[model samples]
Target chain A: MRRYVFFILMIALGIVIGIFYAQEINPVEIVDAPPNTLRADYQADYILMVAEIYALDRDPAQAARQIALLGSDPPADIVNRAIVFALEQGYAPNDLILLRDLSEIMRTWNPNLQLEPGGGN
Target chain B: MSLPLRPWYLLTGLLIGVVLGVLYAWVITPNEVLETSPAMLRSDFKSDYRALIALAYQSSADLGRAEARLALLEDEDPARALAVQAQLTLGEEGGTRIAQALGQLAAAIQAHREAPDDPIIASLQAGVQSPSQATSTATVPPPVVRTATADPAGQPTATTTPSGDAENGGNPTPTITPTGLPTATATPGAPFVLLDIVLECNPNIDPPRIQVYVTDAAGSPVPGVAAVVSWDGNSNRFVTGLKPAFGLGYADFDMDPALSYSLRLEGGGEPVDNITGRVCEDAPEPYWGSWRFNFVQP
Candidate 1:
């Protein structure tokens, strides 16, 4: 009886230790993601909204202010970068034009400042 | 060598194993599993991830956030990567949407560059000592600021009226002038209320075309009105009194079937019409596309 009880306790102890070791080895726990997070499509839509507003107002300064909400780069640099990015992204001609027009308008509005050269059409 | 085992010992061992196994499987294991790495994500969700980053940039406008989000996809150049993906997938139904999103992203970036605190804006403001000073210093006459006239509701109101010469003649001259330019004796003047816009797709022509019509409050077609059509980053100005097939109020422009287009009457508020290209399905005579827009004075 003593031997049997001793063996049973030993087995239980081994399992408990094994569980602890397994946890230590792989500590990652699956977690649920938070809700209300923005998706990529939503982000793209926001960008379109900004472009529409810029086109409507033709106010580079105001447009820049709104764009600054997205990133730290100067508006002109951002525009130039965006142009290159858009072209690289294979954006439609009309969509590219909207960005280009904004860039041109910005350049026209501030000729003295040197803006980054745009890449391939 | 097998040890002599008792039934009680065997039963006890079995029970212990079962309980512990269940506990380990249920309580010890994590609830969520990360099935994919960033590398795997790039292969699977490259375009979607890029679009999300672009969209996120709009709300946050933070390059760092954009970078971090892009990093999850292991992309080195977020914009360029998206552009490449867009190009690769061009003509696919989803391609248009991706391209549009990319363009919006670029526009947002450009807008950010023009912010008030930007040196460029500051310099421009500083350089302009006065309106007179600016005008005097400029080599050419300052471009007129043609703000689109907005109605009480803030919507741009485009009105078409016959030019002084055209109005004098009860019957206007031929639609196309001797020089081959489509001429409309329309001047930008009285505010004709814009009633509606109609879009028609005609695939009979080689590159498709968009025809526009302008009318007055009495529903009579207004002749010699000017309209501007813009698409694929280019703009063309045309006038009514052309395309006699659609009558004096009608004007038309050839368009690429693969492209979408927007139209604004010369005195722009917002674009009066935006037409998306649809596949032409004329048996044995498929052409790119076409559209028609109707505008009226309220």
Candidate 2:
């Protein structure tokens, strides 16, 4: 029984060392992350820009394509999330209006036409 | 059943444990990568980011904010990035406005970076609300306009007209005061009147611009004045001094040689109509070039 106990102790030590090495020494670093990897705030700002351009050009197809680049969130949902985030963050009234307008448009856009966001996030 | 204690058993257990640990650490759970930067974006997505910044700058007209946002891209030179992208994609469908915005922002940033000491640029960096803020985001109403008092017709010219010293050739002087606060010499409460029109013949100007320079009676370039360009029932409004590199008192509109445009400044003046780029015979090859229009408040 003492011999078995010693073996288990050694195994536990080895496992601890291996975990430490894998996690701290040579962990994977995602330097080339996709747009979907952006934080919630940046995602909101990027979505706002799309709304501004959409307000000008009124190109739903291109607008949908641009928003879809961020991730697979349905265009309307993505915009709606941004609107909520914008409101929470106290975005200017004009900017909030633009975001809401975009959300409305995205709601009607055909999701079947949405393009897949490229690459792993 | 009791077995003899064996070193092999200990080694086998240790090896198995290590393998499992490594697998679990690497695959089962890892540090979540949060707050990924714009700099880390994929190459194509980086282009999209640039477009977003450019478009935002077009509406916001905030030079300082544009620079700060662009810095996140980790570009060695943000202006060069904008210029190169504008050039590469200018010909694509639906790319005209994006290319123009990128090009304009690129020109503004490049000018700002190059002339850090200019007072006008200094004031611009300090940033008060710009004239663009007065106009609506989606559609800009064209400002009122009138003809030059000196030239009744106000037809754009390849050479300087007889308004004032056109000695600077077709080019508007880039910066007036090397050091000092931004000049307030521009006549307050007055509208910019068409003063001169000169066509520039430069090999570099491919999509020639309708370059505008607004100055006061003192010939000091003015910033923050509004101008409008209309062609084929479509109108666009932009404020001068936005691109300080061109000149603190300068602003320009991209002109398609195929289309003629009408220009109007904010105060009452005869609108400068029939504005279009003409061929520059003096160039090494015949090239359609930019038209330069000078406006001054009375």
Candidate 3:
């Protein structure tokens, strides 16, 4: 009986040691990104890409689906914010013109939605 | 009941098994185990992300920020990476919005390198220098300036007529005659010759479109000319129209991709024959399939 108990404990100890040693060999690292830290520039790019997609498909609902990826804000609100951001950032006039045209189309598509005045000062 | 049990043997066996298992898990298996992270994107998504960064760079004109974002893609050459990805996507799925955006982004990058002083580039650079000044000063005048410079000898005539017509907001019939006559007279006795032909195939658009431009030997755009495109075994006849945006020389035609095309100048010039359209990329659907024909009367 004594021999059996000693053998069982030794085996258990070996298994535990093996697992502990393995972890030391390869440690898992965890990184935490801050919450609500979406970069505004990235968001702006996302909005522009969505706008381009809208231009291709001409489907407001489909565009709205893409805009939803940014946040809960409506597509029009996101577009308005993007336009303001692009203007403030001094995006090329041609690109700004396209964005303005997109905003107009979006407004016409969704009458209830309010958009910021385009071509900012 | 068989042989006497030996505890030492059992203990040794367990120890051996544990040691072997640990060695396999930590040493041999480590290499075999594929490490994946939620943060890591697949190759396709990574390419799409790079293209979006490129487009954003176009708008923002922030190279430092663009490079930083591109670095995260872990690609040594982000532009080439994008091209390869775009090619693959086009081959697999014909012309898609993603594929189109990728191609345009690549073209834009190339264009920026070629023409750093271009209005878009200048504005972008200015935006980097002083945002407020960029917005105020870098409005859309460069193209207008280019148009003005193209007619340096006719500056007096070019400036007076166009500006007058522009202000009146009336049909510029008077201005057209003056500009057209000078272009013809400027180049004395230059034969109208076929300059070059290009085909652009875009699967994204149905019924491919062709753009034709006519220019003088001096490369001045010649307006109010007709370009004809036809293919063998097809009764359809195609003609080019003046596309002001592309210049006075520009004309366009929507063509059937299945048939080959031949281009000839309506009034004179040799015919450009045996023009065939193919899938621009290996994508399952044909996108951006196009051809360009240039006619020059030198």
Which sequence of candidate numbers ranks them by TM-score, best first? 2, 3, 1
Which regions of candidate 1 deviate over 4 angstroms? Answer: A26-121, B1-28, B32-47, B58-60, B73-81, B88-91, B100-298
lDDT of 1 at B253: 79
lDDT of 3 at B258: 73
TM, chain A, every candidate = 0.48, 0.71, 0.55
User: Mind giving the per-residue lDDT tens digits that candidate 2 earns over B220-291?
Assistant: 456556678899999876655445445556677889998989998865677999987689888568988787
Runs of candidate 2 exceeding 4 Å displacement: A1-11, A110-121, B1-22, B30-35, B91-94, B114-298
TM-score of each: 0.28, 0.53, 0.34
Residue-level lDDT tens digits of model 3 in A21-95: 676755333222211123455556456655554454455655565566556766677788878887777655555
Better of 1 and 3 by DockQ: 3
Tell me the tens digit of each residue's lDDT in model 1 across B1-298.
2356655576567567656845674475533333332334334344554654554443333333344445455556544565455444444664544443443343222222222433344334334422221111102211111111111211111211001111112334322111111111234564444554433334445565766666544343444455777887888766553333334355677777666778777644357545766556655665555555656664
lDDT of 3 by residue, B1-298 (tens): 4236675567785796568557756767545543422124555445545655544444333333344455455576554565555545544544344443444344333322333334444335323422111121112211111111121222222211111111223434323211221122114445467655555544555566666655555444454354667777553322221223343345566777677777776656677776665567647754656676666765
DockQ of 1: 0.04
Error of 3 at B149 (Å): 26
Clashing pairs in 2: B145-B269, B145-B270, B146-B269, B146-B270, B147-B270
lDDT per residue as tens, model 1, A1-121: 7767766775676566556555665444423222112233222322433554455445555555555543565555656766665565554554466667766655565424533333111
Task: Report the number of the highest-DockQ candidate.
Answer: 2
